[model samples]
Each structure stands twice: as C-alpha cells, then as structure tokens.
Target: MMNKIFTYSLTLAFCFFSTVSYAKKSIEHCEATQNTTSGLSSCLDVVKEAVDRELQTWINNQVFILEEFALATGRRAALDMFKRSQRNFITFRENDCRWQYLAISPGTGAASAYKKCYILVSKSRIKELEVINP
Candidate 1:
C-alpha cells in the first residue's frame, strides 16, 4: 500500500510540474487585443522595434564582410554606383537585401567588360555564391 501511494504521489507531482512548465509566461493575445487604444499602440511599437533590431542583426554581418571585400578589391566605386542605382534597379529591389552584382566601368563613361567589373555580394548570399562564378 505504501509503495502504491509513493508511485501515485510522484506521478501527480510530475504532472503538476509538467503543466506549469508548459504554460506560457506571456499574456493572452486576446487580452492584448482587447486593450485600450494607447496601450495597444505602445505594445505594437515595442514589438515592431524588437523585430526591426532582430532583422538588423541578421543583415549587419553581411554588410560588414562586404565592406571588407569592397576595400580589399578597391571596388568602392562600384558599390557607390550600386547604392545610387538601387532605387532605379528593379531587380535588385526584389532581392530581400541580399547581395546583388553591380557591373561598372572604371572610367568616367559607360560601363564595359574591358574597363573591369566589380561583383558586390551580401553576406547572406556569400556562402551559396562562394563556389560559383558570377
């Protein structure tokens, strides 16, 4: 009888701890949704800022490596051109901030293969494109 009682007690204790552990700490979505106008706005703003920072962390590393590559290759000219042209380049605008190749001529005029071209890559796309030709 004592052995059975011990087993039952352990099982009950385990279930209680398990349920508590599984419970979420965050308030319910419906509770937030029902909040006053200003409160909801503040909550949304906080969430938005958090999401933006997380996104920046993901893209910042790629920017750092690309900056190093640009300096090493003396390709800042092409990078400047690409940034200026991004608003005009429809295809690049669609790349989700991933690296895009920009071809530029070293001379003042139109771009050409003879003058030399610079390949600009984003950090996110570097691993996949490393072994491949541009």
Candidate 2:
C-alpha cells in the first residue's frame, strides 16, 4: 500500500510537471523566443497584461448581460452566483499563481512562472465564461 501510494504520487507529480512543461512549450508569445531571462520576463509581462485585459472584458460583458437579464426576469440568483463565482475564481487564480511563485522560490523564474500561471488560468476562465448563458 505504501509503495502504491508513492507510485501514485509520483505519477501525479509527473503528469502535472509535464503539463506545465507542455504549456510552456506551446506558448507562441514573444517570450517563447526570448533568449535572456530579463527579455523573457518582460515579454511575459506584456502577454499577461493583454490576457488580463481580455479576461476583464469578458467578466464585464458577462456581468452586464447577466444583470440585465436578472432585472428583466426578476431573477437575481444567476447574477449573484456569477458574481460570487467570479470572485472565487479571481481568488483562486491569485492563490494558485502565488503557489507557483513560491514553488520556485530563490529562482529567477518564479515571477515569470507566476505571471504565466495567471495568464493560463485567466484564459481558461475567459473561455468558460464566454459560452455561459446569463
């Protein structure tokens, strides 16, 4: 049982690390081609800022639509839930990225990793919110 648990833990770790690696590799941003850490960091910042703006736009549009629908139909739960969920998601993103930063502490890549994590998570949330009704 102990051996099994250890193996399972290793497998999970491997999968997580490989997915992160694949995501890092698959990014087509200017950061991908940057040779210097500083250059890569700067490019990642720009990319993350763009992603953040897009995410905010999605959130704003969704909230506005939901708010209008709620006002017309007298159903506020959807809007309430959506607002709550968005708050939770933002909190989760911050904590998750903070974890990513801490995971690589004492390294030059931690900040970049944190920004990349934020970009990746926010992009996923944007996709999820895009198709949501109300």
TM-score top scorer: 2
Q: Show model 1 residue runs off by greater than 4 Å.
A: 1-34, 81-134
Model 1: number of backbone collisions: 1
Candidate 2 residue pairs in clash (backbone atoms < 3 Å) = none
| Candidate 2 whole-model C-alpha lDDT, 0 to 1 | 0.73
Model 1, range 1-83, lDDT digits (tens) per residue?
A: 46445544654464355336323311233234635644543443443343333324333333444565587797776556534
lDDT of 2 by residue, 12-130 (tens): 46435644654544346556588877888888877776667656766766676677778779999988998999889989999999998999987998988988888889889966865
> What TM-score do all the candidates reach, one by one?
0.34, 0.75
Error in Å for residue 85 of model 1 = 7.6
Question: Which residue segments of model 2 deviate by more than 4 Å?
Answer: 1-26
**Candidate No. with top lDDT:** 2
